[model samples]
Target: MAVTCDLSAERFVDRWSDYVGAPPLTCGIVDVGERTRPTVSGVDPDRVRTVSDPGNLQHLHDAVETHLSELPDADRTVVYLDTVNALLDHVPIPSVTGFLDRLTSSLSALGAVSCASFETGERGERTIRPVTETFGTVFELGRLGRSLEPTDDQLSSDDVFEVLSSRSQRLVLRSLLRAEGTLHVRELAQRIAAAQTTEQPDIEQIVTRLHHIDLPKLRETGLVAVEDRVVSATEVVTEVEPYLALAHPDERN
Candidate 1:
């Protein structure tokens, strides 16, 4: 199961479509946010946790802990908290840092993967300092698809179809699919790089292909459009999904 704090489920999928093909129970997404948005049709509603109060850090922290406890000690759990900017609007910067300190350490103890976003600013910097100091890997996102910095937690999946059908498209496509709003070519490159490899990958090369090639291929299928470096997935992506479902090895568990 996945736990998302302050991030919309649709936005998460638009940013990471591979979850669509993850193992049965493993693909669940628990949304801890202030309101409910439209659910992605192919997505299971039961997996989403819609909390009304997003400002409560302790409540959010406790909710995340409970979800983590339900998984096995070795299971690869992915906890994604959207931009810390929203939380900073309500919670103190130090409190947010302390909460992340405990939260990340707890996730590390479980051997789970976790990542979150932070706006770039003086306050954003202070809040993210402790987080960056603790997490070995951290980076900024660019756009072609969208800006999504996902951890490796849910990177493992059994179905290996649809979302994983095209090696050339997986990372780029998933990032576009999960975008909650406007997406750009540069930000997409950053998100894809962070998701697929640890070593620094060529951001320029990836952006070139998305702008000149992949985005056009996706456009041909009416899944997305790229004009002036801004990319948006068509409604077609969601409608054509049910037919592409792949059998997951763990579903038989």
Candidate 2:
């Protein structure tokens, strides 16, 4: 079952087909909104259930719950929520998050795979930060592909400067570049402190800061990736590396 907030059921199926190949014949679309939009030619009308108002969360939940109760193979089912951004316009973050938490819990108990999409932007990011904690796994898909790596045209000079402004961040990029793009947090922290000529580096403190601040900023900019206490540099870091010196000219001398 899929709950679509941003696009019509047919459009969502079209995107799903494009991304993951043709959706199953058993696929169900719980489209949220009116039927003013024309349906696609090939999509099945019986498979789609629409709630006229996007703000009608109860109706949407009832639609999905009714669908779930009828499913014979719960394990084969996949629940998709194509976006939370549109819903946020109608409901508060807490309500949307609460609904998601409940839905995901129910889906998990049924052995169903749950997937959701949330757009990224200043406002979207604020909502996603908290919502992300609800899901067990999160995948970030860029405009091009699964890689969060931004293309040259996507990143401007100021964007690069903003990311590389911190001395610790610059050092991190340099170290990752030298290490062939991957290092454990402890090793990465040691390398960072070593570059600063710290004789007695507090490794734990450095690691804590990286976990909380530096790594997240770099990951957000697509300059690096952090997973399981390991940090890896992305192509963006290598591409904008020369500008690192210019970002902090004092570091050069």
The numbered model that scores best in TM-score is 2
lDDT of each: 0.62, 0.76
Put down candidate 1 lDDT per residue, 1-253, tens digits, no spaces: 5455555767666656565554344555657666664575456665555655666777777767776676565356677777667666777767777777888887778787777776655555555676566554556434443322333422222222334466445555556655753488899888776765448888898888777777776676556777787888666554333322232322211
lDDT of 1: 0.62
Leading candidate by lDDT: 2
Error of 2 at 71 (Å): 2.9
Q: Please give, for residues 1-253, the per-residue lDDT of candidate 2 as tens digits.
A: 7787788877877877899787656767787876764464455566667788877777777788777767669888988888888888888988888878888877778788788888766476667778886875556556775643455535556667777677888888878877889999999998888877568878888899899989988888888888888898887674566566455534443
TM-score of each: 0.47, 0.54
- Candidate 1: worst-modelled 10 consecutive residues by lDDT: 244-253
Cα RMSD for candidate 1?
Answer: 15.3
